[model samples]
Target: MWTEGQDTCISLGVMVCVVLLTGMARVLVRRHTRSTFIRVFVAELLATFQLCCCSHELQVLNELRPDTPSWTLTVIYFLSLVHGLTLVGAVSNPCGVLEQLALEQMPVWLGFLKIFAQMFSSGLSRTFMVWVWSLGISSRHFAERSIKCASPIHIALPEAFLVEMLCSFIFHSTVMHFQEVRLKFRIHMQAALITFLVFAGGNLTGAIFNPALALSLHLQCFHELFYNYLIVYCLAPSLGIMLMVLMFIHFLPWLHNMNRIHKNE
Candidate 1:
């Protein structure tokens, strides 16, 4: 006869073991000079599996033991951060950082252009984030209105929002490093243009390009939680992307200066 607490403990233990093993695997895989696609695919698959397990376990625990305390929410917050960090770190293009550090080999104008492109990418990233959020909001609203034909549910849409923001930070920061490492054209003007188009397209399609947000929306649609598909898909990406851009812009100077010091030393 497994008690609720015992079951929860076992679940948590399994989650921890999975994470530790995944990290170890990542380290070992990184040491092997394998093909880029293989390494990336393996790393991303492992990381996603780890996060999915942890998130599923957490959601189950939250549901099974309703009326969670303050500390419980705090734990959820920490888990969310861990999930975001691991996911981004594992999948981020390894060469981006290397490119950013090699900016000294570039001309001043080229360096500025690189930074400018990053800013643009970061901005687009936020826009994409907001657009996803809007979609989630809109979908929920439309569904409820069509069914109940009344006002929208006044639910607080902050938890999923924060989770999405944290993930965006991890993603943009990792990409910024990759942009530095892999940038060849002095500026990612072409890539920037493509990103803009995709960002817009993602909004219209209701595909946030973010698994966590998608999960949150699913929870709402399936479990009677308040998830505004439109808001999630249309508005949240933009906000998240903008915030990331501001942080990266501030950090760009420090990154450049660090490279100079390293070279001199």
Candidate 2:
């Protein structure tokens, strides 16, 4: 068995390598490409790939060291912050792309392209992480490689759906509200909110609020029906985003106008 220290070092090395390579790619793409579409595509793919690979590695660490909740939460917060800071001009989540589409901030074709890039990178990340595990740099990784895929949901389907939905709602709502906030503070707030949501709902549903992320981390698991994953992981988060858009973009403004009319009357 590999030592704990070795496992930690290997996991950190993998994450650092992912970030460095993807970061470099993004820089090169930005420097070389004048087309906004190509730049966005490359950014989305590389950013989502980096996010998924690090997340998958952390999930392995969580499984291998189940007792280390603090470590897991800390790492999640740090990586979320890093992602928020580095993923400029990239929507790494399909849900975010759809939200932009819903609000007319992005054109239909561009949204579709972004979603495609997110999903393709998500799947690619899964394969890459599996190969990393197969290398068996540590006993933890070796053991993780042989483990059968299992569903993350530990509650009833309805409850699991609600957990994911609520998590997504809160997260997207915060993102909307943070639009005017300065970038430095906004990144920290976003990261803190993600860490909090993960802590709150992690036990029940793994608190994954991104459809692309759920696809990467849970879609292949065997313990649940495929439809079940669709309901809780995919549909619920999308619904949450829809609700947020409706409230923020449509309902609230209409309500305010109605109230003002009543006051005038």
Candidate 3:
């Protein structure tokens, strides 16, 4: 028989798979719905649920695994790779929707609706995770291990906020840069950068730069109006993404100018 930790990991893995596949199925089934919002909503909701499960499972495994430093980092890299490839609809990120809004590529009303759908779906997913944990602990023999929140132990709130802001800014800039790169490299680049940032700042801000997940998860830990959730998770990411877009806009011409100078010389 497997150890309790091992069993819990297996169960969590299964849960993540189920939720992610459900989301993907929504993408496939979109033809029947004929409603863009509904399809997007289902995909976002289920995909973010899968993300939460993966995050929680990572937490559980790091504690149970041998030489957590090595195993955890590897798992983080694998998860990031899976995330970039699977979540094709840009599920559960209000900041991504905001980026679209800033670019004037999406209608304001549609963006707001997407954000609302994301939040609602995240809440449902979080609730499902919590409920599963509660039932598993009480009803099962091998699923007795504990779940952990990403606690900012040593860092100050302001520092954590700054870390989140910088992380988000870098993330959005990378997204913009990736758009210009070939698709072959984009997913790997996404995995590498996402894993890097999570490894660097996960302890401080749960490494969750996604506002929808932040609102669903962290809001449960802190008070309703807590700065930790608002400033770091919500506001900082939006501001960071906005700034990234602005900087990209203002400097885009410099790239052509530099190329022209190089050719002339």
User: Could you list the CA RMSD of all candidates, in the order they appear?
Assistant: 14.7, 1.6, 4.1
lDDT, candidate 2, 87-161, per-residue tens = 878889988887899989988999999999999998899888888888877776753552466677899999999
Candidate 1 C-alpha error for residue 50, in Å = 1.4
lDDT of each: 0.45, 0.87, 0.70
- lDDT tens readout by residue for model 3, 28-95: 77757887777766766666767766665556566566456666777777777777777776546889
lDDT of 3 at 217: 59
For model 1, the stretches where C-alpha displacement exceeds 4 angstroms are 31-33, 77-88, 91-213, 216-235, 242-265
Ranking the candidates on lDDT from highest down gives: 2, 3, 1
Q: Quick one: ranking by TM-score, best first?
A: 2, 3, 1
Q: Please give the clash total of every predicted structure, in order.
A: 54, 0, 0
lDDT of 2 at 27: 79
Q: In candidate 3, where is summed lDDT lowest over 10 consecutive residues? A: 138-147
Report the candidate with higher lDDT, 1 versus 2.
2
TM-score for each candidate, following the candidate numbering? 0.43, 0.95, 0.82
